[model samples]
Target: MATTLDISTTYYKSPLGLLRIGGTDTYISEISFIDHLEEGEYQANSLKGPVTPIVIQCIEQLIQYFQGQRRFFEFPVFQEGTEFQQRVWNELTAIPFGKTISYLDLSRRLGDTKAIRAAAAANGRNNIAIVVPCHRVIGSKRDLVGYAGGLWRKKWLLDHETKIQYGVQTLF
Candidate 1:
């Protein structure tokens, strides 16, 4: 019989709030805020089978990130999305922590000057959150735009990154 991917979940209290982290025996299948994850969705998924080492490692790294002890991550992540979404996410990671990019700019970098909406949608559906660096995307005309974790969280994250870069203490 084919082996099923084992999954598990736990709550992580961060500056943003409580985040739900889920993973399979081989990798993290999903990570989202409590409000973002449909009720029972994470629980149902975590029972699918043994936890993966990579996922456990991701969990540890996430804790470190939340504690502000780590800046960048070096872990394997497994997420499901379209090829275009994956491409957009790849570009998001390249943005570097503490920097911001306009959605239109990101679209152009992806070679899709007309796919701004698609780019935003891809960012909206990003499951890996900070790891994928989706928060780095901003509106071309404004300081903040739509964020799955809320605009306040977006601002806090950006400001936190800025503080870290400038050697200033973050209020959040």
Candidate 2:
């Protein structure tokens, strides 16, 4: 028999707005903004399982991240995806917090220059978001595109990180 899992959901306010953090017993499963998922909708789906201590740690790390006090996150996350996606997310985390890389560059780094679209798709499906750092991936032409959190939020995040990297005041 397959192992059954129970998931937990919690809402927290962040600079991006209200966010719904979801987790299974051992790892964080999702982190979606309220505006994107709406309230009570995901709750109806019955999260895959209960929140574990590691999941709680991920939540706390996210809290620190949004406060601009954390430059990197170290937390366990469980994402469901194909091998390609897993590879893409893994490479995404390797990107430093305040830097940007192009999708074509990522595709090349993956040793397949033609896999840009696949790379973008993998980035779009990233469940762990900021922790995975998929936002660091941009268009080959240095344009921001295809963010699950919306382009505006992507720009905000990049700009914020850039400001933080330069030690400048981050203000819209």
lDDT of each: 0.77, 0.78
Best by lDDT: 2
Q: For candidate 1, write residues 1-172 as lDDT tens digits.
A: 1123355665566667777677765566567766565787655654333445766688788778766677898776767788999899889889977788999999999998999999999999998878888888988975688889888878888887777777775533
**lDDT per residue as tens, model 2, 28-49:** 7778755756466656643344
Please estimate how well model 2 matches the true structure, expressed as its whole-model Cα lDDT.
0.78
lDDT of 1 at 75: 77
Question: Backbone collision count in every prediction?
Answer: 4, 6
The count of backbone overlaps in candidate 1 is 4
Name the best candidate (by TM-score).
2
